[model samples]
Target: MTRGLTPSVHAIWQAMGLVPPPGPLGARHDFTIEDTDLILRLAPDGQAATLEGTLGALTPDPHEATAQLRKLLRLGLGLAGFNRAALVLPDVNGADAAGAAALMALADRRPDQPPLRVTAQARIAPGDPRAAVAALEDILQWRSFARDVIPASAEPATAAAHPASPATPPDSGADFVIFQP
Candidate 1:
């Protein structure tokens, strides 16, 4: 088993049967999984890494955007088996942004189009190369689900039409059930 050493993103890439980008192992790299573009940045200490990519954008309508934002937040909180990833919306200045202040800025600035860009990030632990690959795959899966499955507007009737599924298996002995839409 791999241990003690910092996880190598190149190793993870090769393990996933993809060619590593031409660069030093520690450098940030951009790659694609299932046609979804992703950026990988390793921590300075090499103890961890982050995989981030844009999933989509929030709806232009205020009410719809609010609802969409809430759902994205819930997904980031690990709701609906999407715990492997977190959603982020960077501000105009490109700083990590969230909550009301960011929302207000997004609203005030870009009224004609979807102002808030949604990104999904997943943390990769050190040591095991498989873990990093898994994290990348998980984020890609969740990205696809978010873009295809999640509705732009959360209508009561539309929400009720699709029931949620349990995140865990029934006989797993877990006490709680996480329902994903």
Candidate 2:
């Protein structure tokens, strides 16, 4: 099992007022996403959130595990009114880059709300889930910075420039792998 790299995720879930019922030590975080009941068991650098339904959907593609993690977290936060949230992905030698980009593209789908943000930052250890989770702080900062930098009523210039793009960059960092706009 990976280290408890997803403690931040757990905290985020708690912030949204959704938490799993108490259980034995390391109680799994119970929640639903995309109509899927997930039981999140913390690992060393990540959490193992197994799909808890029919055998047809028991496990996600191993290669897409990171993607699945991102999706579940984003969906929950979005429902909790953190729709404009940013995802800070670690540049793990391109390990999770594609997944992060996919998330960014997905983030722009909700034109009604602000675009999703994704940044590939440095100083955070690569191949460590904590790196990605740690970046959450920067993401929250970006949200606040975005509010002040961009006019609340107006969409970002990039979003305006491309009205049909699903990937929008609400904010970006120099080392970040920006997506959408």
Candidate 3:
């Protein structure tokens, strides 16, 4: 059998049959312009692919659901006119070659901008729709001027009740991890 080439941006592009050269990696993550969507994929050692979601459809509100989404999410999604923009948050705790490339892609797209930093506070209110609504408010309150605020909701009893389930714990202190997709 023939030997396979290593996974580089060029190789990935060739694999995708794209003619244009891939851009250098940016602050958020290295992304290649494919059609209308910006794609960032990572397969780091000792770490799962933490960021692997897409931004698309260029909607007034691109969220799959309103309650679970953060209010400031629009800021990130709407920053560019395109319907889809994806950034993969690399696991920087260890080796980050792939992560670095991804970040570089983000930087390329958002030059001179901070790499999508985010901070959030969530509260669980049982049997109260308002709790979810409040969570959105909290996201806006805690959000930095540069970053977008994302409002979320959750149910106290059901694990999935929280509209914004599967959040990266505060302890992780992850700036932004794939936009809660």
Candidate 4:
């Protein structure tokens, strides 16, 4: 709960009970939680950091992809009360792009392989190591919910074949009512 002072990524890692990677400033470190891959990049000044991870791949169907993207956008905007993490669409070149543009790029590049990956990012503020840990949890929660929204495979039959299966509820644990369309 400290404020006003910048903390090094090493300090944050220690606060989270993690071993700090041996690296200089602006280095990137990778970590995995429950099979989900996450990357943390320390700022040049070592005062701030950005934690990013892929939530899931977008469905190949354009219509479904668009819908999924819109839902993520809404969630990233804090409409679902999840504001700690920001969802983004990164192009194959690793440049940040809008959801629609990224989808189009993915379609042009490799329709067979889902190139459009929805990523979640959270900025670790200076002096708040706990916030960094919270950000990681938030991103992981978003990943779980996003996987349910965006199918892992492009085949529609896969979803149709299991239409009877109930969707996995999000693990937010909050008592907010969820609306289904």
Better of 2 and 4 by lDDT: 4
Q: Which candidate number has the best TM-score?
A: 1
The C-alpha TM-scores of every prediction are 0.61, 0.24, 0.21, 0.60
Task: Put down candidate 2 lDDT per residue, 77-124, tens digits, no spaces.
Answer: 553453323334334356666544444444443223223323312223
lDDT of 4 at 177: 73
Cα-based lDDT at residue 100, candidate 3: 47
Runs of candidate 3 exceeding 4 Å displacement: 1-8, 19-29, 32-42, 46-53, 56-181
The order by descending TM-score is 1, 4, 2, 3
lDDT of 3 at 166: 62
Displacement of residue 171 (Cα, Å) in model 3 is 58
Flag regions of model 4 displaced more than 4 Å.
1-26, 44-46, 78-82, 91-102, 106-114, 151-181
Better of 1 and 3 by TM-score: 1
Ranking by lDDT: 4, 1, 2, 3
lDDT of 3 by residue, 68-103 (tens): 234435554553343222222445554656444434
* Model 4 clash tally, residue pairs: 0
lDDT of 2 at 169: 56
